[model samples]
Target: MTSRAAGASLPGLTGTPLDPDQEEARRLLQEELDSGDYRVEESWLVRLWRWFTDLLPDPASFGPLPGWSTWAILGVVGAAVVAGVLFVTRDRWRAARLSPTGPAGAVLDGMRRSAADYRSAAREAMDAGRLDDAVLEAYRAIAAGAIERTLLEDRPGRTAHEVALELGPTFVDSADALRRAGDVFDAVRYGDHRASTDQARAVLELEARLAQARPELGADRHPGLVVPS
Candidate 1:
């Protein structure tokens, strides 16, 4: 018939006895509290704020406190630095993911072949009446030849329009041909248009012309500059 205070024992069934381990734990907790070694319960927000402040450098350790404004400025600067670092790291990771050997393998996703190989393929496709394939191969041959002749660098994911633009500035004499070829290729590739034998033949003829075309160096060009072999 003894009454116990709410904090004297753990609340459970009215007549339930405390286990020996529980009693020991309660005794230890009480001793710690009496000795002022126990921490008071903190709200979640206060705990999170404490953790965040712990991550920052101590202004008092650096020097005498200028003011609260100085601490606020330091906190802002620290946050900006962290944000900038995170942004740069994210960009580098994205670049790596888009690399030739990365997961996407964007640079190596397309068919890699020599100009002669592409020409052979084009001929076979044309003979088989695969006009679309023929046109695609013929365009590939043109791009391959330009790379081989050092007229253009082999860049992945370059659209036909981009190729034509690149060629126009370098092979001024074949600008019209390059543009036409690009237009035809883009129409077949992206515009849902069917390729014709004539279009394929035109692309092949343009490729041949571009293979022989050279860059028109202006008078202001470096006289000592040696062409890439």
Candidate 2:
């Protein structure tokens, strides 16, 4: 009966029944082939999606973000970046506007003009209503006159404030004015300050007073000069 059943089951079978273990193995193998798991291949996009999903938590655990929120966050970040860049550019531009030679004294750097020359330039600038130029020229005159009278050393890089400090004891009455003039020079030269007509006149007046004033006998010596004992 078993042989007859085997022959009837398949035409190639030689009327021989398969053993119980062999039959069970064949059934399991057929089930695996019919499932199509081994024969199917995943596309690159699907594989990439799986990899990305593996890094994230379950979608059910978190609510989806509103579509507008993403753009809002990006816009805020972009604006912050733009503001930071503008701030840096402004600082660098300010630095570029300043003299490259040195401090406030740089206004007179490399110029061999006499104090009288600076005074002439100041007068011309004031007449033309170029108050900024007038202020600068007046400050230069002060610096040049100090060097000529040995009140200040004829040195490069000596700032306006340093010159004022050195001449303060000699010109005791105008000490405060000297300091203020130095501040004004720095503001007009390096800062974004605009010199008014009154400011220009004040600087010119200070320069004139400094020219007429006499330094103390002891203060006449330049820092670079040495007197033999």
Residue-level lDDT of model 2, residues 1-229, one tens digit each, is 8765544633233443444377765876677677776777889656755765466566456588778866875686567656766886996765454423334546467757999999999999999999988988998899898888777777888777787788798789899988877777777886767778888998899999888876654633555422223
The pairs that clash in candidate 1 are: none
Candidate 2 TM-score, C-alpha based: 0.50
Candidate 1 global lDDT: 0.67
Which regions of candidate 1 are displaced past 4 Å?
1-109, 217-229
Tens-digit lDDT track of model 1 for 30-49: 76567755668799656756
Clash count per candidate: 0, 0
In order, what lDDT does every prediction score?
A: 0.67, 0.74
Clashes, model 1: 0
- Candidate 2: Cα lDDT at 151: 72
